[model samples]
Target chain A: MLTLFYILSAITLGTAFLTILSKNPIHSAIYLVLCFFSIAGHYLMFNAQFLFIVHIIVYSGAIMILMLFTIMLMNLNKADEKNKPILSRIAAVVAFCLVALVLLATFIKSQPVINEYKVSGQDFQSIKVLGQVLLNNYMVPFEFASVLLLVSMIGAVLLSKKEHINN
Target chain B: MDQAIIIEKGIFIVVIFAITMLFAMYETLAERKIAAWFQDRVGPNRAGKGGILQPLADGLKLFSKEEFFPNTENRFLFIAGPAISMTTALMTSAVIPWGDKLTLFGRDVILQATDINIGMLYVFGVLSVGVYGIMIGGWASNNKFSLMGAMRASSQMISYEVAMGLAIICLVMMTGTLSLGEIAAGQHGWRWNVLYQPVGFIIFLVCSFAETNRTPFDLAECEAELIGGYHTEYSSMKMGFYLFAEYASMFISSTILAVLYFGAYNYPGMDWVESVAGANIANIIGIFVLFAKICFFIFFYMWVRWTIPRFRYDQLMKLGWKMLIPLAIANIIVTGIIILLADQNL
Candidate 1:
């Protein structure tokens, strides 16, 4: 089980790094898809079947397809993209380090609490249990999340609509 | 798992793989024969009796054809395209309940590969992944037509998927389970889901056609404009994979339709049969009944392909988004209300 976890972690981290490192935007998108798939694999390993399938459906399936379509339509498969200016590159590096440091510090602070693995022997991750938890316990937050998504969807439609001068 | 169970499952999976492949192979022949019949032609009777060996001949021809590769940007992705498509096409069968349990050697053997809790969503997820196959293949070919086909396919699939998911949400609400095996077993002896959720069934049927890229919804590969579409630059076995994947998905989706709406492995007199002939014989018959339903759906797919003309791209999009999505949402709302009313006993 630990070995399997290690392997999946390797795939997740490797593909995520490749998503940034790949030159062509299409390749990067594909790598990001692989990364998402590996994360789904992790969910499956944790026996969160609902989360695993939903993650694949929403991220690897839908978001990645839209990303790939945009990349393909923009004809950005070429590897001849101009390098970012030195100042911007420096800013990116500094931002990356700061984020990494913050994450590491957070993990360290929470290390004692994360040490013990607990199995409650209660049904939690199955579709029924998850639905109950979401709809019953986290009802307000869940509805709010849906509302947020709906607003964003409306925003996307509005953004894509063409503005007619005559109209 | 026990060693015996492991062997049993392995053998079962192998049998299912073989069956799916064989069914897909024959589906191609069936499509052609049906199309020929529809067009008032005899079709290919040259291979075996009634062109029984036609698919084999086609397979041989594909294998012997020259494997041509365009000077594409990425050779790896070009090959990976059909591979992904074919793999995802076959993956959905894992959760399908082919038949009820059969006792053999004093052990009960479930005819399904695996009855995962979220079987329906697994099918949806894998199907959504199927778009990557066409997109990658089309983009890798580096042809304008192929890229355009890929874009059409991806958008069409994604759009239809929303409606399909919504339609299924209605069914899931009615059934109150995500497992296909349970859902199928629930429809024992004429309690089919379609009887209750006919509107949902219709929306799912249309969306399935769109999802599988069948005619009336096959704008992606409309040869009138895009030539061969995503497989425009593909040749030989690679091209065969694309075609085979389509037939395979058609077969699987037909099975899904049967399993979900039409009673899968169930007949009106199934209880009588079980009582009379014992569980083994009854279940064996049930398997055949399931296949019969599946075959009807497959025939229905071909029939629609032949009878209906392909939709224009705009019309297809309008139907998927403007029409089907709203209809499916309404179906869900109505189904929820009915369920709530039933629970309230008012």
Candidate 2:
């Protein structure tokens, strides 16, 4: 199980690096998809099958497709993108280092303890249990999320609509 | 896991893979033969014995054809597209319960590849990924028509999938299970979900047609407009893979439809047969019966293809968003009400 975790983590990090390193936009998108898939693999390794499938469905399936479509629509396949200015490049490097340092500092400060694994007989992550929890306990948050989504969808539709002109 | 159990799983996977490929192969022939019959023309009878060996011949031809690649910047994605499609198509069968269980060689064997709790969700996830295949392929082709086809396919599939998921929610409510095996088991001896949720079934059927890009919802591959659609730039075995993946998906979807709504591997006299002929023999017949239902659905797909003209893109979207989505939602609401009412009464 540890070996599987290491392998999945490796895959996830490798593809994530490739997603940025790849020159072509399409290649980057595909690599991003691979990265998402690997993350889903990690979820599966943790035995969170429901989360794994949902993650794949939402990220790799829908969001990535939308990203790819936008990329293709923009015809950004050519390697004609200008390199960042030297100042911007240096700033980006500094920003990356800062973020990494902060993340490392946070991790070190937390002093997280690993709990001994215990097998729970309850099927907590199954659809039925999840559904009950969502509807009963997290009902308000769930409904708020749906409302937010609906508002966004309506906004998108309204923005995309062509104006009617009377002659 | 025990070595014997591992071996059994390995064998099961191999068998399922082989069956998927075989069914996909014959589906091509069946499509051709059925199309010919509809058009009053004899199909390819030249290969061997009413062209029974036609798919083999077709495979050979595709294999021998010159490998052709269009001028494209993303060669990797072009190749990955069909591979993804084929893989996802085959992956769906993993959760499908082909039969109940068979007693073989002093051991009980489950016919399904895996009996995961989230079988329906897994299928939906894999199917949603199928859009990437067409999208990547079309984009990699560096052709406008192909890109347009891919765009249409992605949008159409996404829209219809909403309806499909909603329709399935009705079934999930009815069965009170997401596991395909459990759903199939619930449909014992003619208590099929289709009988209970006819509206949901029809919505699901339509959404499936759209999802699979069959005729009437095949705006992505309108030959007159898109010029071979997303596969316009592919040739030889790569193109064959895309086509094969479509038929494989069709077969899988048919199997899903059967297992979900049509009482998979369950007939009226199944209990009687089991009592008389024993568990092993009964399950063997059950497997055959399941396949028969799958074949009928496959035929129904082809039948609808030949009978209906392709829908205009707007009409397709309208049907998906306006018609099917509302219907599916209504079905869900109605199902929920009935269930609540029944619970209250009980």
lDDT of 1 by residue, A4-28 (tens): 9999899999989998897788899
Q: Which ten residues in a row are the worst by lDDT in model 1 chain A?
A: A111-120
Give the per-residue lDDT of model 2 (tens digit) for B1-346.
4898889989999999999999999999999999999999999899999999999999999999999888876788889889988898999988999998988888888888889999999999999999998998888888999999999998999898889999999898878888999999999987988899899889989989988989878888899999999999999999999999999999999999999989998988889998998988888998999999999999999999998888888888888888888888888899999999999999
Model 1 alpha-carbon drift over 4 Å, by segment: A77-120, A162-167
Per-candidate DockQ values are 0.89, 0.76
CAPRI band for model 1: high
Give candidate 2 misplaced runs (Cα > 4 Å). Answer: A77-121, A162-167
For all the candidates, what are their Cα RMSDs to the real structure?
A: 2.4, 3.2
How accurately is candidate 2 docked according to DockQ? Answer: 0.76
TM-score of chain B of each: 0.99, 0.98
DockQ, candidate 1, vs. native dimer: 0.89
CAPRI-style docking class of model 2 based on DockQ = medium
